[model samples]
Target: MIFSAGDGKESEPSTPLPPPYSGHNHVGDIEFHEILAGTDNFDESLVIGRGGFGKVYKGCINHGENLVVSAIKRLDPESSQGASEFWSEVQMLSRLRHCNIVSLIGYCTHEQEKILVYEYMPNGTLSDHLHKQGTPLSWFRRLNICIGAGLGLRYLHNDVGIDSGVIHRDFKSSNILLNESWESKISDFGLSKTCPTNQLSTHVNTLVKGTFGYLDPNYFRTGKLTRKSDVYAFGVVLLEVLCGKPALEELVDGEWRNLATWAQDSIKEGNLKNIIDSDIMGEISPKCLRKFVKMTERCLHDNTEQRPTMDAVVVTLKSVLALQEKLSMQAAGSRTIFGRMVDLLPFPTNGENSGRVEHNTLAPSKHGDGIVVAVKMLTSKTRQAYDKRQTKHIAELAHPNINIGGIFECRDSKHKYFNQLLFPNRGNFAEPLSWGTRLMIMIGVARGLTYLHLNKVHCDIRPSNILLDEEFNAKLEGITKTVTKETHISTWVRETMYYMAPEYFWNGDLSMKSDIYSFGVVLLESMTGRKAWVYGHIEKASLVDWASTVKSRIIYLKEIMDPRLNHNYPLQGAFECFDLVLRCIANESKDRPSSKEVLQTLERIYALNK
Candidate 1:
């Protein structure tokens, strides 16, 4: 009665049905003609789910003497998910049976036709309910659904009674289905794989295949598949449920960002209330919210070994649910004061104003350990724009040289603000800097820019955007703007023309190289201690043009050095650094050195001089 997809070499012949279903039953084989009739010629009206694999159709089937509803999935022959994937699902679902796991009714294979049938889920997918359908789910409902899904995963990884564990390679909200009673069931086992049973090996090395935002970074990088991969994806789903946001969001500003990055940043800064779905805000107890956030953080640990098991996740979720239930029973008058603390913050006056930057001190140790932090309120308009601009780029661009900031929500105006580490002597670059200190700052800036470019395309690079700490270490702070490969330079060049490349100015093309051009201007300004543009006899003069003219005469390079240095600079390093600045500002965008190359050259110069 058991069916095998047949190891990609050949399709196994259809097997006969097992004796009347007890608890676990082999997947039944139905005729393709019957499947076609049930689906009504694969009509669009019957289609319920469409994906890369194919279309899922709602259909009716005869089980025993009674008619039953079922979901019929028809494979697209042209899809990359071929016979191997189709069979994989059939084999996996046949042996797995649980209340929270989708049930397989039967399958049909005739000639080239490959189809699967499953118990019909009347309410559709969790993704549909959470995002598409206007009916917002209550906090209680979301928590219950997550708990059920977690239990199902726990069974897959531990209680399945199988020596080799199951790893749901593609676990996300969309793969979770809801029956008529709104009971959650984990579905779509096509990408599921069995982990190694050997005691010595912890994971199975395999090809990396999963959704973009939900893919585990460790798995994606190392190609090691384990149960923890599912944990990472489930963590993303947890964030989606908590925030009521998509796993991957394309903001109004045209940048694609991950919700996990946004959630991590918000939680770290104790601004968890800001990112929560407005509908569920104040409904969750602060204690429960903190536990939920902590669970997500544990699940998303960069190291797979450090991530919690599905069993651990289920226990934590139950604890949170219990806390929520307890808080729900308490009278409003008797509710804990800590739960209402976030609501008592001052109203935010900074709404959509880019020019104004306000600093405030938050209450001590609300979420993280007791350490006072500084908060900078950004306008709601800015938050809306920033949310769309791939906040993950900022989160992932963590380095000693990068001024990474946390995000939070303002209680009064419901505006979101960034919480940055406080440093004394915060000011513009116009302040005096020694030649050695300037070189160190330039190198730091190059390293930070290099990291950003490796992870994302940062189009904004300028001296004003660079902040110096007490020790004069440069920390970059600016919007990490990302543009598509097809994005034209002219789209954003108008707003930042001073540091933009000449090619971008003329042809309207943008790339990572564009940032190098801007970096050149920053380097020139930092060297000469002058503004991007200065007044001359005729009109305004560009820093790039001035630097290029000075470089033409090697001797004038020293004269162009910042007057504040007072001829106390290292001559060899100064000349080499200026040479790099000239290369970065090349008129032909392609002629510019890459950020990595700039970092390497700067490091070599610094080492040689030191």
Candidate 2:
């Protein structure tokens, strides 16, 4: 994937270059059309940074007497990979909008050159304070940076104000820039992916793509990028903030490794005194250091499921900040280090018990309107069973399209026995759904699953598990409870087998690609109105086989559509969805596109029609 002219490793371009191309690197197969024609506004002094992609320059956009400064990201034209990077950024950023994310103001594509314009950050990136020479950032300032970055990421993952979920594949200190007053903004999205909203398509076969140092190790090995992977990268950044060192750096042994493992090893060997940055050595108390280390360790854990979600991380960091503030306030009058330590114990909240789960509902209304919120009821055994997992996963998972209402924890005698409580009904769906409602059910199912897939959180997708609300927003049920040890591994295996790719089922490995396989089977069920696996069928038929048999019988997409709708689905959109389903079910997992890519395809189709 690396192409360089200096090393004599470059390939010839497809088209002839314009004059004055000397010393400029040529992109092998990429081209651009300049949107800002006859403009000479780029400033050389504003050049901020450089990378394999290209240089980032500060620029100004003029309108009459008013001026607006912005960051102009231009392709080096000679980077060889610059063209791909340019288009990739445009393709991803154009569809995203969030408070924490930097805005792509505009772009210029002309004469085979690509340039992206963004709002400028006067304070520069976190890399400046942490690594590059600058006025040293205070510990509180660093904590704020982590909080802002987490909020931006959370917005990308859950804020449905945009078209789909966004996963910033390259998340790191360098990618996080600070503006005036040090507010952090996530700056890049070229390698991001959005899951397809419509399940009936072929976009799930695309191959995995991302950066090296920040890349999720599991994803790098398995080609399955999940939200946990992003958590892993964020964990590395958190460790950097704590240890005051890069995630991967050269050590005394002359080898490169992540600081998380190195710091953990130090802590294990009783050498914590050696790892902390000397600048903040005496200033930071053991209580603060312990909580910070514990939080970072949870993030760096090997199991993706074990890593806290961005929401949870944000909450944990805030709690840490609160504890830090309390200690700082108490330390103002302390005479000795031991006295400070005695007063540094974690102060319990004033409440008799932590907050309990509560439920709310939007009165039943039109299609997609009425939603029954799952409140974690303290008195309910079902809610107690659901509390085994952390609350961070549930509270942070809200979107106009995502179905998790609200999840809370309480310590009351009635509620203390339960671990977690879910909204509305917990895994019960005997109520008969109307034909008209089923179509909405299909769409809701697509939206929620698409969110999970794109965000890299794969729910155990199944028919009996898919719940429907009054508005028929398909909710992925059965996750509120804790899994027993004996059934855990086998359940995951069986779930994988139900919709697993042939190669994976034969070999018995769980992967993100396996989710794509499951999605394809789920799409088949949505289209044909059949379960993936039947309990008592004499033939022991699989959903995939039934879908193939009826593929030819599908004269019109509605003909094979879920009868719950009575075949009154939207004609073209439904058909297009069916086509996507066909592609998703393509025998090879390699043929499936990543959820982000699929989401883009669906957006294109939705745009064309809407």
**TM-score of each candidate?**
0.52, 0.47
Q: In candidate 2, which residue ranges exceed 4 Å CA deviation? A: 1-43, 63-65, 80-84, 161-163, 196-208, 251-254, 333-610
* Model 2: ten consecutive residues of lowest lDDT: 415-424
- lDDT digits (tens) for residues 1-610 of candidate 2: 2211122223323353332212122212212322232124444566787787687877566423545676767777776555545556665666556667787666666665667777788888887778779667777788888999999887766563434566666788888989898889998776665543222121221234554456666666555556666777888888778667876776577988767677779666544544555445445544566677777888878877788878898998888777667666544422211111111112212212223321221111111122212232322323334343435445545544444522222112222100011111456453434333434554555566566654444435555455543334456543432222112221222233456555443333445566566666766665565656433232234566656666867565555666655655456766676677777767666787666555555554454445
Instruction: In angstroms, give how far residue 531 of model 1 lies from its true place.
Output: 40
Residue 156 CA error for candidate 2 (Å)? 1.2
Worst 10 residues of 1 by lDDT: 415-424
All-Cα superposition RMSD per candidate: 18.4, 26.7
Q: What is the C-alpha lDDT of each candidate?
A: 0.70, 0.56
Candidate 2's TM-score: 0.47
lDDT of 1 by residue, 220-302 (tens): 77777789999999999999998888889887779987888878986665344346675675466555766898899999999
